[model samples]
Target: MTTPGWWAMALCEAVNDKTPLAVAFAGEELVLFRNAEGQAFALEDRCPHRRVPLALGRVVAAGLQCGYHGWTFDGASGRCTQIPNLRTNEPVPPRYAARAFPVSEGNGFVHVWLGEGVPDIDLPTDDYRPVGQQFTGSTIVNMSHEQYLAAMLDGPECLLNFAHVRMTDFFLGDVRKEHGRLVLERGAVWTTQILPSNFVVDYPLIVRTEVPVQGGSIRVDLLSEDETPLISLAIASGANRRGTTSLCWRGFVHAEVPAKAPLRWRTARVWHKAPFTVNSLIDGSAVAALLEAPSRDLHAARPPRLIPVSAVV
Candidate 1:
C-alpha cells in the first residue's frame, strides 16, 4: 500500500490529567501525556519487560511510573531509568526501552507519526482555527473513520444522503472550508449553503452552526429551495474549556464518484429509526473498514487506516 502523508492518517488529543491516554488513530496502544511544563510525549503503551499498558500508570517526578511493578521511564525516552528497589540511581536499563513516537503540537492538540520517522508537519493552520462552532452538545458515536470524514465535506449529496438534508426542502452550502474556492473543475460556478442552525466548531470557541459555502469566488448562504433561509436545524455543542480539542479539516475533489458504500440514501434517515448527530457506520467503505470483517472470529488490536480521498485529490 502507498503510505499516505501525516495528516492523512493521524489524530491528536491532550493528556487531560490522564496519562497513558488511549489513542486509536494508530493501530496500537500509545501512552500520551504532558509533562510539568505542559510538553506532550507519546510512547508505545506497552512496558518493555512485561508489556503492561503504561497508560494505567501515573506521571510523577517528570517520568511515568509503571502501574504493575512500579518501573519508571523517562518522559523524553522510553528507557527504564529508575528502579525504586535498587539503591543506586542508574541510567535506564540497557535493553529495557519501549518504542517512542515523535509528536507535533499545535492548535491545543498533539499529532503523532505512525508510519516512520517524521511525516509532514505542513498541515492546515486555518483548518484547526476555531470557528467557535456550537452544536446540541457533546456525544461520540461509533462511526468508522471514513464516515466521520465523508459526513464532513462530501458536498451537496451528503446533506440528503447521510445527514438527512433534503435538497428540495433545504439547500446546502459551500462545499469547501477555508482559502480554496469550492468550484467545479473548470465548469459553471454554482455555490450552495444549508439552512441548519448556525453551529461552528472553531478552536477555543463554540458558536451556533451555520453552514458556510463558497463557489467560484462567490459566497452563497445555503438555504432551502423554497427560498426561505433554513437555519433552524442548528444546535450548539460544549466549548473546549481545556483548549485542547484536536480539530481536523479535509478537502476531497474526485474526478470519479465517491468510494463504494453499502447503502446509498435517496431521502435520508428513512432507513434509521431516529436522527443521530454523530456519523454512523452503516455498511460502507466508511467506518466498516475499521470493523475488519474477515477477522470476525477474532478481536482487532489497533485502529484501521482510512483511505483519504482528499489525499488522492
Candidate 2:
C-alpha cells in the first residue's frame, strides 16, 4: 500500500557499496544497495526463489548476492546475474528477475519512486539548501504516520522543540497551498519573555511548517518577527512497522541570528550545536489535547490517486 510518489527512503550515506540497507514503507520491505561503481538501487527485499530477504545478502562485484544461496542480482535491473550451481551453458531465466525500482539521490537523501511509470514530480528536497553545519538524526516513534502528520499541523510543539523558545497556539494565517505543499504559520516567543494575558497584536518569533500533499517530506523554519529565517529543517517521514512512524531529519541554524535571541541560543550557534530537538518520546496527553483545525483543510486539499497494482510487484 505504498503511496504513489517519490518518497525519501534514506540518507545517501546510509546506502553504500558494501552493505544492503533495509527500509519499509506502508508495510512493504525494500532493500537498498549500491553497485561497485557507487550507483544506488532499490529492490523488493524478497528473493523470488526462496523468499529470503535480499538485505540479508552481501554486495559483490556484479551486484547484491543472496546470503542463503549464491544467487546474484544486477543492481541496475534486478536481473539474476549468477547462479552458483547452474550448468555451464545454461542461461539465467529472464522471468527470474527480482523487482527493481527507480532510485535517485540528492540533498543528502535517497529517494525511491513508488508509483507507476516515470515520476513527473521534483524531488521533495529540491528547495532545501543548507548554508552551514547541519544537524541530523533518525528515529522511529510510537505513533502512526497519519497521526504524526495531523499532529504536525495541529501541534508541532509536542513533536519537536526549539531551545529557549515557546510555541503558542496562535496561528498567523489559515492553511494554504503553496508550491505543492500545505503551509501554515504560527506565533512563537522566547522562553524568557512572559506572555501577556491580554490580546497581543504581534509576536517576537514565527514558526512556519510546510507539509506535502502527497509525500511525507516536511519543512519547518524558525524565524524572526519579520520572517527572517533563523533555523531551517527538512524531515523525511513515513510508516515503519506496526503503528509506528519513521523519521529522519537534517537542519541548520541560519547565519542571520535574531538580535533578540537569548544568550543560550547565541552560544549554541557559536559552538555549532543543534538549536532544536525532534522528540522521540512524544507526550500522549498533549497530543490528545490538540484542537484539530488546519489539518481538516490539509485532508481536503490532497488529490486522491489509485496506486497501480503492478508497481508493487
Q: RMSD for all candidates, in order, please.
A: 14.1, 2.2
What are the per-residue Cα lDDT tens digits for candidate 2 across 212-313? 888779899999998999998999887778989888888888889788888888987798777999999999999999999888887787544324243432
Candidate 2 residue-wise lDDT at 25: 61
TM-scores for the candidates:
0.50, 0.93
Model 2: how far residue 238 lies from native, Å:
1.2
Model 2 scores worst on lDDT over the 10 consecutive residues at 304-313
- The digit string of per-residue lDDT tens for model 1 on 1-313 reads 2333332112233364455564544133567777777677777778887889888898877578789888887666667877767877555556777676666665434555445334565532224332222122222234433333332223222221213332221213322233432311101111122323333121111111222221001112222223232121221111111311112221111122212111332222233322223322233444333433212211121123322121110
lDDT of 1: 0.38
- Give the total clashing residue pairs for model 1: 39
lDDT of 2 at 135: 84
Clashing pairs in 2: none
Positional deviation of residue 275's Cα in model 2 after best superposition, in angstroms: 1.3
lDDT of each: 0.38, 0.84
As a TM-score, model 1 comes out at 0.50
